[model samples]
Target: MTAILITGGARGIGRATAILAGARGWSVAINYVGNEAAAQETLEAVRAAGGQALALRGDVSVELDVLALFDAVQAAFGGLDGVVVNAGIVAPSMPLAEMELDRLRRMFEVNVLGAYLCARQAARVLSRDRGGRGGSIVLVSSAAARLGSPFEFVDYAGSKAALDTLAIGLSKELAGGGVRVNAVRPGLIETELHASGGEPRRAQRLGAGTPMRRPGRPEEVAEAIVWLLSEAASYTTGAILDVAGGR
Candidate 1:
């Protein structure tokens, strides 16, 4: 059976991906820092989709937690076929000059360092050189990487931009090892991330500026992620797909 693990799987695009992977008959492992209730609900939904799922609690920013998350998945499902590094956080909009060190540290810790740690584990589990079967690694980035949300969180944008480079460099490094690395940059998507940024209706208000004239649904992003995980994208790697609908 195909087994996949997703960080921040309790909500937003991560939740949608977990549920959809379940529907596709993949054993899903969900990692959530807090909100056990939401994680349980997501686990139940995955089961409803006819797939086995385990909701594990851990903060990806912490090395011990990251280790525990991957350990739990390996023990439960034997090994992983794919991993989605999606656990991240957003602070209220603030210019780089106004942002405090703590905010930047937290953002880079969870978004950049956390992703690096998860990718490292995925590499170990999915590398042919390591005596394991190879698999896919998908990094959930943001359009803000390029757009650079001025007057908002430029730090977040900078961090995701770093992730884009990680995808490209890591993909090239692992291609011969049977592991494919790629990323999806979602635009103004309708996710709770906006509210966390202190703008709950930001997607609705700003989506009209895009050519699509609306924000994307979490499911839309999930589709791209799952496809990347599937064999259909066998020839694709190091790709940073933009799902922003032409912003």
Candidate 2:
């Protein structure tokens, strides 16, 4: 059976992907920083959807924690077949000039650094030269990366842009090793991430302006992500797919 590890798998796009993967009979290892309750709920939901589940608590920003997360997945699932670099954070809307050092530091630390850490570990374990079966690595970026998210969290936009570059470079780096790397850029998704950014209805408010005239659902993005993780995208690599509504 396919075995996958998804960082921040407790909620939003991560949670939706876990449940969908479950429905496909894949073994899923979910990593969450806090909210064990949400993780446990997702665990049950995955099982209910007919897949095995494991909830691991870890902070992606911490190297030790990230190491343990991969280790735990290996122990629990025997080996990993895919990884979703999805754990990230967003702060309140603000111009670049007004942004505080601590906020910028934390933003990059978790978004960029944490993503690199996860991608690094994924490469180590998924590379064929590393004595493991090759697999897929999917990074969850954002449309903000392209839009620049002007006047609202440019730091977050910059951080996500890093993921886009990571996906491109890492895909080529691992292509000969039998591994595939790609990223998804979701736009105006209705999720708790916006509330965390201090704009609870940000998606809904701005979604109307998109060509699709609506915000995307987590499940919608999950479909694209899970496809990249599946054999359907067997020959696809170094691709950045936009799940945004043509914004």
Best by lDDT: 2
Per-residue lDDT over 105-153 for candidate 1, one digit per residue giving the tens place of the 0 to 100 score: 9999999999999999899888898876899999999999999999989
RMSD of each: 0.7, 0.5
lDDT of 1: 0.94
Q: What is the lDDT of residue 225 in candidate 1?
A: 99
Global lDDT for candidate 2? Answer: 0.97
For every model shown, what is its TM-score relative to the native structure? 0.99, 0.99
TM-score of 2: 0.99
Each candidate's lDDT (Cα)?
0.94, 0.97
Over 4 Å off in model 2, which ranges? none
Among all candidates shown, the one with the greatest TM-score: 2
